[model samples]
Target: MHPEVAQLIERSHRLGADPTITNYAGGNASCKGAEPDPVTGSDVELLWVKGSGGDLGTLTEAGLAVLRLDRMRALVDVYPGVEREDEMVAAFDFCLHGKGGAAPSIDTAMHGLVDAPHVDHLHPDAGIAFAAAADGEALTKECFGDRVAWVPWRRPGFQLGLDIARIHAEHPEAIGVVLGGHGITAWGATSQECEEHALEIIRACQAYIERNGRPDPFGPVVAGYEPMPPEERRARAAALAPLIRGLASTDRPQVGHYTDSDAVLDFVAREHHPRLAALGTSCPDHFLRTKVRPLVLDLPATAPLAEVEERLRALHAAYRDDYRAYYERYADDATPAMRGADPAIVLVPGVGMFSFGKDKQTARVAGEFYVNAINVMRGAEAISTYRPIEEREKFRIEYWALEEAKLARMPKPKPLATRVAFVTGAGSGIGRAIAERLAAEGACVVVADLNTEAAAEVAKGIGGTDVAVPVSVDVTDEEQVQAALDEAALAFGGVDLVVNNAGLSISRPLLETTTADWDVQHRVMARGSFLVSRAAAAAMIAQGLGGDIIYISSKNGVFAGPNNVAYGAAKADQAHQVRLLAAELGEHGIRVNGINPDGVVRGSGIFASGWGAQRAAVYGVPEEKLGEYYAQRTLLKKEVLPEHVAAAVVALTAGDLAQTTGLHIPVDSGVAAAFLR
Candidate 1:
């Protein structure tokens, strides 16, 4: 590859990866270079354009489609309007110099027409403020002073490419071009020069914005709204997430919640928030992620669950109807088929913004974009009324065939994608393994533990901050248990699976057992289990989505060992409780089950807290050999690992055991004495 082309690929990725400048699907770049034609063995000018659906941040050689520059330029006359989008794309594909298998960016013609060796384009929020301004051309002059060319907005296609080519021809000395109500473009002899030129234009726009923007008057009003504490707020978000999720889709969608950002609060608190937020996004590119406008929902901060649920249903109906009307108004022969009309974003007055997608990552991406979009809206509103590209333009981009192809290109979702799992005592041991495993299987996880730092670390390790969220929880406290369930709900819409794995053990001869030891054991194992199970069930019921509740039981629950009265009794209570809960909650589709493992001493919380040494002493074996001794005692002579326990939890929640509920899955290496009939 030519050094200049390599430089172009690197520079393009840098601009594409930055959400402040461009999102995952927006922006394009290209470099003109000479390459050996496969058939002729002669150097020919070729355009290395960013491929369709390729993210600039992660662009590689494969992402750069190699197209003959001569062929691209020849299309200037043959370029048809948006109605022939398919044909134009086919022509670009046909011009490929080799079997690269990547489709050239739809903007290849525009890039080819530019005389420079390198070209870069981006949809930076700062630049959008200038491009989408009513006086965008004047702003372009004010910012660049004729150093940059100006081209009015045209629906992006053959005509748009021709017009851009004409602009470049007219302004032969210009460093960049501002496409009014669209995006910005820059060109130079080298890739670095093009990148530098793009940044300079963006900085100029930023300066213009800083000079003309106004101060936010309601800054204190939003700041003073006094949100509920994190736990309560999380609970609220979780409680309300299912209601909103139910309204958003008919396929029993797995909904999650995201409402803890400063930008969200600021936007949601404005007195004119409904009108301002509903106006439109900053650019047409965002239409694919955020829809043309967010669904503005008015729910009081102090509203009860029933009230909130009712409001969500009403608002959902109105929002969908409005979306249908918008589509009906804009649908025409030139547009692609109308896609799903669901609103991806929800704006709550005095609360914050919530973004929904098919899975956790998608939802997070939407939220990140909305956060950036809010700042863009802020920048534009400060200077003048923020005007996005018109609705018709957004409609075209939203339903564009190229954009649909991008969606289709994404990999198929995992089986548990979009599912949310809440696990207790997830800081370490079997709980931690289960959390990690669930996240890997595509379920968003809430890591709840008494160890705050450990829980945080576990969450960070699972899938970064977005996929796994950590919350400090004490299962013995009713309020904390309920709050933790809420946190799980809010973190990922609503919890579809709950793992009750938090427990402790007490072992002593019946005569020596003390009140303190017995109380502690029962408090943690029995009362803790009850509290967590009850709270999680309520949240799941409210979600109106049938889910799973898995209790980590003990083999001792049925086959009690000597000197294990307190621990064994509590474990037994959990087994019976699981059956009762399953029988009662079956009507609501909540399946309750248990996993009984006899001697998973190593790496377990019980073992970590000195239970292994104590139990080894009782068995007349050295602590180092305790694990082997316990394995030898089982029928299969196999070690019961934390991962084995975790597998049972996964099996119960993953729809693999969909028909089998209220049953115990033993992970004790086939302990015949402890096995359930």
Candidate 2:
């Protein structure tokens, strides 16, 4: 390859963010100067470059344009509209007739304006795919190793040159440039070198596309772009800013507002990915920017702006207000989060984007979201298109305490945990209770307690399968655990959630503790937790699905609980083992947390006599009164039940706990809280 061509390829390959306009004609590459190459001082001084509209894949020299570089650059700078464009056309007209009728690229003036020794451009599919991604810059880096400078999406021309100017200022070593949402620009020291670099970059893009691309599955859905009058456009855009901002959100129960793109009208007006907005946000970050989905506005719908806005406003307020109520209900932050900015997403029917933000970060994020949403809306025309996990699931992921802490650097979730989960032992007890909660939120659940009787009963009780399922699993044995998981997978198509909630419990004064009793507790509590956890984890890992594994431990591990050494230690060991297990399996994306509830009594195996029984005796009350007596000692004055513990299990297993890999929720009502008291 020519040295200049080689440089071009290296730079383009280095920048994978450019979205080739396959829908438009491909890119144009050229080198123009007032004079020809100085090879042996030959006076061929002129532009020798790829001709107009040449596909980069199989381009040739015969396709190049030889023009006066300075003239080309100067024209590119002033071409405001048809008049200037006509002037540029005339310059090339002279070059074509006298020099040769080689049609220069549509961007010929653009190429000449840059004043580089060598220049190249191409519409690479890899760059387009990367550009289409939500995290365009980061994805660009991953696809292209190095050599290209990054640029975000912008209209072509002067702004693009300004970008080049910035690149020159920033990186003197830069050989090429990438325009986000556009295409790559490569240049080198010589014509042949620049051509080779352009080809190399195209090949890289082709390779990436071949490796990952699926068929478009549709004929071209490209649409025409007509400019809107600036005065009306700006007036509408400014007027609509607050409305759009209100649409963006980040709270589980949304609180932030964001902007929406008018381009979405073309997308959602169709019968495609627009459906996803009906379901939910495409990605977690979308919630912060677009409020799960856009509140579509269409030109076909004969509605007044005020009426439409007012009606949708209530609709928007309904969602935002509902989300706000939800946030207030579940969130524990010192400062309350806003549900959404306000207006929510709006589609100006056929206009481009009208999304808003507090600043560029927010606005750009909102715009990026509209791009994805619009694309999905387009893609939806092809396949099932877009579907979202439940809103409650989104809330969980958004509000996860640990996940909240990583806001500064975290990207978005990949929808790996978008399915439903059903935990055993939900109800008034831990197992039974988790079921009701996961159900109350959105998960289609199968609540399994030792109650097989309860399992079938709850299934029948919840009715029709839209909601809950009660199953019985003697978690200590491999057979029952497998059966429950199999049934759950069969019912849910897959289990994205798994919480092993069956364990043994028994209490004894230290002197009276027996080996057989210890063996029984370990067999059921420790062994049961292990057997269930192992099977569940294997299924999740093998499915290439990441999930959560939570152990039911007790306060006996660390706190001083007399005569509960075996039970406490085993529970502690369970916690320790899972912590290590979490570390080892972190790359797999599985999370494991333990729960040590100090006061729960569905069937207390280890804590039967120590806490509950002793509390009854100490308080001089009947066993029933022990619940009230213990409630007074905890931080909150509520009786800790199996139900309460179950809620904690659901949180750890749900989408909200993205980074929360190792933790034990102490569900002793206020027992753990009492220490604060």
Candidate 3:
């Protein structure tokens, strides 16, 4: 890579990783460099800009699109007659340097218009304060004096690029330009120079705010209403997660949730929050991700859970109706086709705030933009009333063919894309395998284990924190179990699948088994299963969406062995618990099932805990051949693998057996001796 191009990538990552300045999906950067032309051996000038549909923080070399400089500049001269958005996009497509990978950013022309070697464009909350205000142009002049130029908000397109080029020509000495109700752009001869100038512009605005007395955002707006304390706010979030997730859909949709961050609380606690939230987002870029306006729900701390769910359903319907009306109100022959508006953020009065995403990372991006919006609006209100770009302009941007194409290009979702799963004892062995499989199938996983380090390792292996979250929990402890359940709700909306797979095997005969060993076995198996089931059931019920609960039992539960006393008894009780819970939860649409597997002890906690040699010696078999000994005894003569057990778990949870529950499925490679009629 050219040195200037490498520097652009590094600086873009820095800005993208910082939530205060930009989000996972927004922002763009570019550098003018020279590369060998594909057709000839000669070097040519190229505009390498960040491409569409990739996160800037983890962007790679392939993510940048290289375009012929002269071709891009020529579009300005012959673009007067082009009115259709698709034709404009085609003009950009035709300018790509031969066989270049990825589509160039929609702002490619805007970057080319600036007469600088390096250009940086970002949406920082501090800088957007000036642009999103009613008196933004005057404030922009006051803060930077003559160092920056001001451009009025225009929909990003060929015309906007031409206007920016004209402004650059008018103010030749300016180092940066602030686009009203959009964002900021900084241009310099070097990458470092551009980044520094961008930061300098933001800090100047922040210093200006510090010098003036900050105005109270909530003083006279809602005088009688008081906000909940931090602890109560968290409690309310936990209780409301299921209802929100259920009201979202009935396809067992995977949903993720986030509580009030500092910026979120600051906005929702204000008395004038309703009026502020009614306005559109500061930038058109965010409209595609978070919609024009959020869905505001007036939930109070005093509302009962049942009543809250009913009210939430009504509010959801109303929000959808309003969205359709708005789309129809502004749409006409000139506007591009639009998609249905889905609510991305939820605001609850006196309780807290919540944001939803298809999965964990997407949900986080939505929250980041909403939080930035709140802060920018607050700053604008401090100077003057915040006035975002009008709704009609946002509608045009939201329905633009280019924006709609991004969503259309996305690959087909995995089978469990919208599901959230909780697995206990997920530090290693069978539980670990099950959790990994769920994540690979696109479900967000919550890894719970008594070993904190092991749980953290599993989470790290999953790659993204939003996709896999780690929490420490001792299953036998009621409080710990309940807390784990709450953690899942707070992290990923609510729980749809619960795997009660946290138990150990103890090989002891009734004649020699000590009370201590027996007690430990029952506590881990019977008691733990009871506590986890109750907590998971409550969450699934509250969502009003039926879910699945799978218990990992043993073949020994049905066919007793000579030395097994406590292990066999506990497994039996656990299986029965599944049937009992299924009977009771059926009215709520929740399914409960169990998996019975035998002799798959290799790599299992049972063998790792020192049962391998002891059990082998009793059967007069070599310790290393214990697994083989058990396999030959099965009807199919095949050893059961951890993956085999994992596949059964997936089948039951995937709704293949949606109408079937209450019975344990065998996964011991055709073990007729342990099969159920």
Candidate 4:
């Protein structure tokens, strides 16, 4: 790679990594450098810019769009003006250097047309504060004087690029310009100079705001609007998350993220929150992720839970209706159909914020973007009135043809993409495999286990907080089970899939199976499954999204194996719970099923905990050969592995067996006695 290209990537990373500099996937950087031409064997000037839909912090060579500078500049002559500027994006492909690196973004023209070696376009909260202010031009002049220019609001397109180019050419002494109601753009003769200039402007703007800003910018907190205590706040957030998620997913299912950060809490509890939130986010990137604005739940934080829920439901319905009307008012013959009328963000006085999207990362990012908007609002309102772009302009960007085309280009979602799974005993063995498999198929998993450390390790391996979260729970404790479900709701909206896999085995004859042993086994297996399923059922029902409940029952439940009285009875109880719940939950679209595996000794937590040796002694087979002995009795002569059981779970929930419920699928490698009759 050329030195400048490497430096550009490094520069992008430095700027993108800081939230104060830019948001995730929100900015673009470019460098103009010479590369050897394959055909001509001569150095040709190329513009390598951050590609569309790529995050700068994680950018690589593959994420940069390489375009021939000469061809890119030539498009200016054929530019059809602002009304037809979108056509210029298609023309970028023709300006590609070779096959191009990645798809060029809408801002490609901004970098390519600028008359500088390096250019950086970013959305720093401080800079956008000035841009989003009512008297933004005057504020820009007051803060930076002639060093940074100010341009009036204009949608990103060829015309805006041309506008910035003209500004750059007109003011040779200026380091950058704050685009009105948008973001900041800086350029330099060298990569280092460009990065320095961008930082300088951002830092200066931040300093200016801090030095001159007024106190209580969002206004003083209203009575009863102060944030609740930490524990109580989270508890409230947990209780409301599923209902909020259900409302947000009315048009399409969405994963959720919650934040009770000081910034969100302070903003939400303040007197000006309703007004500023209704004004909506100023930046296109912010509003696109956060919707036009948030749906703020009216009423003080001290309201009764029932009253709060009632208000939220009414508010959500009004939000949807208002969103639909907003779309209808601005839409034209060529506009893309309204994607969905549901709000992506929700705010409650004491409860902070909840943001939703098709996946956890997106949902989390949406909340982050809203926080950025809050920061921008603070700075703007501190110095001057916050004045975002008009709603029509926001609608234009939100429903842009290019954005719709980008959405169309996205790959189809995985089968379990929007679903959240709660897997008990996911620390090891079959439960761990099931958790990992569900995540691979795109479900967000809650790895619940009595072994906290083990559960955390498994969750980390599956992709950390974004894809999986760990919860320590003793399944026998109903309170712990309920808390785990609440954690699931707080972590990813609500539960859509529950795997009752936490179990133990105490193999012994009736005489040897003491009352203590019998009670312990039943308590962990039967009562545990009941507790988890009941709590999860409430969450799923609250979400109003149908869900799946799977039990990892064993062949011992039906096969009546010797020296297994206590264990077999518990398994039998679980198997029956599946049938009974399946019959009951079908109306709510909840499918309850069971997987009966004969003898899963390898990687079996139960076997490792002494059950294997006892069972081996009973069958007169070596402990190590127990799996083989069980397989020998099977028609397929195959040892049932944890992965096999995990696969059975995927089969039941991944849609092919959607209509199949109240079923018991045996994963005992074709054990005749274990077959469900």
Best by TM-score: 4
lDDT of all predictions: 0.78, 0.54, 0.80, 0.94
- Order of models, best TM-score first: 4, 3, 1, 2
TM-scores for candidates 1 onward, in order: 0.89, 0.37, 0.94, 0.99
Residue-wise C-alpha lDDT for candidate 4, range 571-675, written one tens digit per residue: 999999999999999999999999998889899888999999999999998999999999999999999999999999999999999998888899988888777
List the candidate numbers ranked by lDDT, top first.
Answer: 4, 3, 1, 2
- 362: Cα error in model 4, Å: 0.3
After the best TM-score superposition of candidate 3, give how far the Cα of residue 509 lies from its true spot, in angstroms.
Answer: 1.9
Instruction: Please give the RMSD to the true structure for each candidate, in Å.
Output: 3.4, 24.4, 2.5, 0.9
RMSD of 4: 0.9
- What would the per-residue lDDT of candidate 1 be over residues 1-677, giving only the tens digit for each residue? 77866887779778977787877767888888887888989999988888877778888888888888888787766766656755687788778888854777677767877777888878888887777777778878877887987788866666667777677778877888888777788888888888899898888888888887788822435443445566566656666776666555444464455767877776776665666677787566666777888887676666676876777778777877898899889887866666666678887654566778888667767777777677777767777667777788788778777777767878887767877788888898889989999888888889999999999999998867668999999888999987787666567777778888988876688888898888888888789989988887777777677788899998989986888888899899999989999999999999999999877876787887877877887888998898899899888898888889888888887777788788988889887888687
- Of 3 and 4, the candidate ranking higher by lDDT: 4
- lDDT for model 1 comes to 0.78
Model 2 over residues 159-230: C-alpha lDDT tens digits?
455466567557766667666545577776676666566656656655654565445422333332222345
Q: Write the per-residue lDDT of candidate 3 for residues 250-330, one digit (tens) a residue.
A: 433647567576666656656678888888577766666678888776655556767776788888888778888999998
Candidate 4 error regions (>4 Å): none
Model 2 local distance difference test score = 0.54
Cα displacement (angstroms), candidate 2, residue 593, comes to 1.4
Identify the superior model by lDDT, candidate 1 or candidate 3.
Answer: 3
Clashing pairs in 3: 253-418, 254-418, 254-419
Better of 2 and 3 by TM-score: 3
Output the number of the lDDT-best candidate.
Answer: 4
Off by over 4 Å in 2: 1-418, 601-615, 618-621, 636-638, 669-677
